[model samples]
Target chain A: MPLLSALGGATWRLSGHLARHFSQTARRGERPGGEELSRLRLDDLAPTALSAGRLELLFGLSPCLLALRAARRRVARLLLQAGKSGVQGERAELLRAAEVRGIPVLRPRRQKLDALCRHQVHQGVCMEVSPLRPRPWTEAGEAKPGDDPQQLWLILEGLQDPRNLGAVLRSAYFLGVDKVITSRRNSCLLTPVVSKASAGAMEVMDVFFTDHLAGLLQAKTQQGWLVAGTVGCPRPEIPGSSEIPITSCLEFLWDQPTLLVLGNEGSGLSPEVQASCQLLLSILPGRQLPPGLESLNVSVAAGILLHSICSQRKGFPEEKKRGQHL
Target chain B: MPLLSALGGATWRLSGHLARHFSQTARRGERPGGEELSRLRLDDLAPTALSAGRLELLFGLSPCLLALRAARRRVARLLLQAGKSGVQGERAELLRAAEVRGIPVLRPRRQKLDALCRHQVHQGVCMEVSPLRPRPWTEAGEAKPGDDPQQLWLILEGLQDPRNLGAVLRSAYFLGVDKVITSRRNSCLLTPVVSKASAGAMEVMDVFFTDHLAGLLQAKTQQGWLVAGTVGCPRPEIPGSSEIPITSCLEFLWDQPTLLVLGNEGSGLSPEVQASCQLLLSILPGRQLPPGLESLNVSVAAGILLHSICSQRKGFPEEKKRGQHL
Candidate 1:
């Protein structure tokens, strides 16, 4: 039955006028963009934010063997909530895979699916978690460049929006960034909204929170990391200037570690941090790389800069060899 | 007075819980995302489909702007009055820009923003725009090797989410990609939702649409352009491989044209497009790369790719000669 009809008492005709009215009311309440979630009670939800820390996702349309192919140690259980008209065909294969993983097969009630993810879009299955064993910063340093090459890490200063925070994480992960050091205040901690927004990139990132961002940059610079702050104002040419192999500059790591610092959404980098930067880069948009439009969202700007650095190092020798030899 | 105060007189607290339940009932006759707007007769408001002929946007914020902006020649405004508010600040700028260029902005006010945009948040501003203006496929040939390029463009395939669409445009403009192009069917066109998501790039970009994407790709390829696509499955050994400096490979397009094509959100580069590609590369996430996450949103992916290409070209002598070099 259509959700619309279920709520009505009598057979109501959806006169175009009435439908028009209904839609307008709905639109007013809707927030612009993806943050329009109706809040759910933390208690009723079987998954607490605390417990969710241990979870891994098994999401896809039916037939892809991603969930079922996981090793036992890697997965804990499979969850399906597709009622009597339950999962069939490829989705069944996924269930079998979960069984093989020795993961429990849990079937949630249909209403529960609505409860799990506010929107009724969780197609059939989800997974109970197998905790991700915590790792230390040194272990997280796997992203560091070898051969005395330069590497890039990002320091996020006071990002408030969860979606923006999530976007930065996703950008950092895909762009070969080493790690992200974020400020504890006025920042969104990793949450479900962050997870969903990141589209599953939340798993491998190394995010640590600290009190002072400026101090961290200073300390890292002392340890041989070239710290560059993304500034709002114009400045000198970035390191290596003309013919500066961006990829090489990014991978340069200056025999020292490298840290790229970003600031708040509305405000650009903090004055203190800007003063501390070895190179204050204003990623201009054109030939005379201009200052950003009155303001550029921090996360969006971060993606632009990170991509620049990571892209420089995109296909080192081997891939080129493969492209050439293949 | 706050909108909530008006509701309090009706015996309801304005808390989210009450709002949620109230929404369920009051929304029975309401639209999906906003307030119930009064519908105006067709005779009262003149409207069209897309201001650009490529998108179908619902202008429901300020109808006056709709009247002012949707008067372009090629633009057709479809008013979603089924309760519609016309245009907002920056988006109005696009429609207004189109109007200035003699493109007609349409104003059909019967449809609601929700109906036109499904459940996506259009912010009461929707547009039916022509595809972004396509650049001559031959333009890439103008860029020389080692010349810090003056202008850059980004080409994408199959990016779906409007937010990603908006974000990519936002980053592209901020980072300096002058234009953007994508397949008509697989890509989301510039709608009011996209304009809002873009923060303002929708107005700045020369976005173009094409029904036959392969033809566009073929045209560019024939123009001596090097097209690279990002592929990160099996998580390559050489992450960020596509970013390295290949003076040898780039020399081919140093004075020629270049186009970096990003594949779909999840399944990047269709096999067909990949086969047609000059290079298939991947951005290595370093050790910080997430375990199961496949990729970043398409626009973000493009941001990373375009930034790398542009940054690399900056190192060349030609780019520096063009102007005050960064």
Candidate 2:
């Protein structure tokens, strides 16, 4: 998160963006309403000290409290609404944890906290902590042989919804995904709402940020890794749509080191991203509804796909599998 | 919707509730804050009128537009924001359709529209249409034998969020479920927010309402329907934990007449509701996530389960099945 640290692998441009983000987020309540504020670039935030690393502010009770108690990164400060004197239950435990850690707890006015979170659901709490740094994309090359499971990485291309991205992260981590890679263009970054949506999965998930996503995917394909992209079926009953030849989640190859690409929420995969995919996969609709009625929400699709892929990888005894009514 | 039609099945109890709704929604800007108003029940609604079987006043562009285009039931009146004629594109088309149908169009001021919607997101349009009537539970018995696919019904118990209920409805209709039944207690009813979230699925979906939901579920069980309830597993990797013998969704019996019951978003199935389910099933975690690191959002989970069950019902070519990835 510091300018110097990012210089190690990422270009100076990313560092400048990070510097700007700290400044923008620090200037609380600069805007009257913040639907636009949550979708801010790193440059928007005001600069804060990154003694341990880049300082990022996280909001809402779950993320803040989770970060305070469980995050490996340093929780630099805790922010609470003024005159609240700390809430009961989980909130009280958060305050206690902050006290135990000697972290400063600021009881700022509700308006200030509201502005900081851009009027999103903060539930009257926030936190400043070390930035969650993604492992270098190049690290995949240096992995020791046989050290990891068949690598499964998720490449999110142009996912606009922060919550969707967060939900995917939760599923990805839960399903034992090796890493998550976000395409630099048109992806929601680590925002407070995204953190809350993940229910703290944001803190521990292994993530990789990269530019030139299509090119990188192409390179990975050349290296013999299967690059599978998700193509949403408007009607699952009709699997072989006009645009792409799609395999159901049940058919997706599990033995290979694979990279699954999820595209923008509205549009399916971009032409470039789709070209990089060795196979295209989708969730087949079971019961045919009216035309255009069977489209699955993207995050739900991700969960189903992840479950399917993960279960194949961990082939436990068939007896524990119970009766297969399918 | 002509008022005379509603004179059929609904008791005076519903009319009294409808009357209350009109007055409450009309008291816009009445609440010092609108959060409480937004969460009010139908019984809490201030009453208006049911003339000629029409119960008017819906909100948001999609529901109003969708109502005009596809709604089978009566859509009595369309309300556009004042000073803004139904402009080009979808809104304009909606206006033309209403004109062709001889439905009156009123352009109320935006402020009044906001008040009527309780400051919820209306997107500058509202419609006054008769509320969707729920098919009686006895109608399930009258369902023609062997004509439809093995019947699948969703029974929602105690869902608090209107958006979640609406989302479940969208998935239900999309996945080709036969009927949706909601407990009269604690479930968010069909509201404008719900309609918008469903993208207008609320208008056409077959819904049944029952006051004694537990009793009805029991009766359905007695009638030889396999009532399956969803039980959330915090750790899917370690199932059969003291609670119930949970089966994977893949193992869910699709051949039987099934009624899947989903419980409150926060809590799993209640004791009484769980009692009705002959089988408790869940989507197992494919990978072992850290403790408390993995819980699927209820709606996302719903989409996944629905797709899984639906896909199995419509088995395609065995060759296309492409080897069990799971």
Candidate 3:
């Protein structure tokens, strides 16, 4: 008993120490474990002394090799996290390719890695090369036109945590979302933390960064998109009270360019964003969702929402193949 | 951009200094933000000078309130961190609560409170009262039995980080997981930091602690239970192949006592637990299912796995009623 409480107390003190340390390190623009190496800024990282090679992040050694082969003409630098050295002979071969390309390999020290990128478990390796710049919104129509029935886009409003942002991005990719957009001021960039968390999804997704979210959303709405803001309160159109029936939501997706908007983790979607949207959908909190537990981690909430959406789209075909159990 | 990064860096340094200061104070077992007080080991905290009508913990109003509520039966002393008064209605009410209970509210001199609480987020009060007893495994079992179809449990295997454990617990409760079971040696207990992150779920949850997990698990299996370890490569019967519908896998739960086991966040589940389990499940990563991004935050992974299990149980019926879109 007393021993347990004391241990508990010590644990609290240790975490506070750690969180405070990381928060401070982040503010100083230095890695956590590094001794103030340089008073450098993000601007200091600009293409300066040399054109650091354009690195493309791969989900695993296999994709990395394929990517290395496809983009061999443009390759300059290849980097992998030290922790992820377990891939088969292929990863070793990629290392050999880097050796052949005369590309300098950079492995970030674990403890010093930025918490955001480090928290996402990026399999230890991320490329720092300039990525394929996302196509302009107009050109983004190539994959699935704004009018396509199967298209899905994730809209984030005031999600402050980078881990949450990264997880949301990863979830978006897993469920086959076409694109992700966030308010630049309150959102995180496709940093190493977000990249790692996304499990290299950052390398592939069409992530649009902007400060003018309201304007961009307004344009999206004008293009015949049905924007639904997930909120705290229940609405008739929202499927299950506690859990959304994503299949139903997806049925409406083919007929409409669907934009699923989620609000901040602390507060639900803002009223300003809510009022401008076509519908306000919510996952009811059981028969009676308590006020404190009402809020869900933005990423967890996004997973449920995206899963519901995908289940509706994909689960439909399966249901038809096999008659309903119930 | 440079200016912003510089400013951010400054904030990080300042935060680090504060964290260090707190850490040193904690080592000495002093109150938060107070001068060097006497050092006390874990054993010294037992029967810590409790007096009737008084609660003496380093100052902060929040702790005062919590202690008051926790020690309603015989709280005798109220110790406020020095120079921590004259806030507003909420803080002022803290004093009133102590006075109403006839607790001898003592105002420690400036820095004394800091020394006592090791200078963390004291919020104004600390108390000396009866220790919190560990809820037995049987009691935890009754909170939500392992066999309940709706019940969700997080069985952690050798997870070392308190923050990750705390985050997973918070995710479990928010995502409707019934309880979290962890080996006593390998896990951290419910502490102030965890309690804060959990947003009070710790108080409500029945966290079962065990010293021998393998033995406990053996007992569970003896009762005809199913253990699903979240590891193992793709198997035809496993859901990792995507060929195994989530609904079918989950339907197996109706008649069996099911346990969803989670392993170390960075490392995969240990071979012992994996070998002992009846079935092993893995989240298929990618459109084609790749490797690196295959790993997920234990908490995030826990949320997804629990969601997958619960969804299959609850979602199938709901889907049938809505009628298949196909």
| Candidate 2: Cα lDDT at A59 | 75
lDDT string, candidate 1, A99-159, tens digits: 6655556555656545444442345555544432223233444433344455777887777
The 10-residue segment with the lowest total lDDT in model 3 chain B: B3-12
> Taking the tens digit of each residue's C-alpha lDDT, what string does model 3 give over A27-81?
7786433323233222212122123432223223433554455452244445465
Model 2 chain A: worst 10 consecutive residues (lDDT sum)? A3-12
lDDT values, one for every candidate = 0.50, 0.65, 0.51
Ranking by lDDT: 2, 3, 1
i-RMS for every candidate (Å) is 7.5, 5.5, 7.9
CA lDDT for candidate 1: 0.50
Name the best candidate (by TM-score). Answer: 2
TM-score per candidate = 0.58, 0.71, 0.63
Docking class of 3: incorrect
Native contacts present in each candidate (fraction): 0.23, 0.36, 0.11
- Candidate structures ordered by TM-score, highest first: 2, 3, 1
Q: Write the per-residue lDDT of candidate 2 for residues B1-326, one digit (tens) a residue.
A: 22222222221223544544455655663532123433433333223334343354566776677677775647655767777654877788778898899876656677666665656567778776666656667665544324544778888888767666777787777667778888877777676667766757777777888888889878777767777778666334333433445677866657767788888876777777776667777776656555446466677777767766766664432223422332
Error of 3 at B35 (Å): 9.6
Summarize candidate 3's per-residue lDDT along B86-162 as a digit string, tens digits: 64665566577777877555555545444445544455565444322235455565422443645556688877654
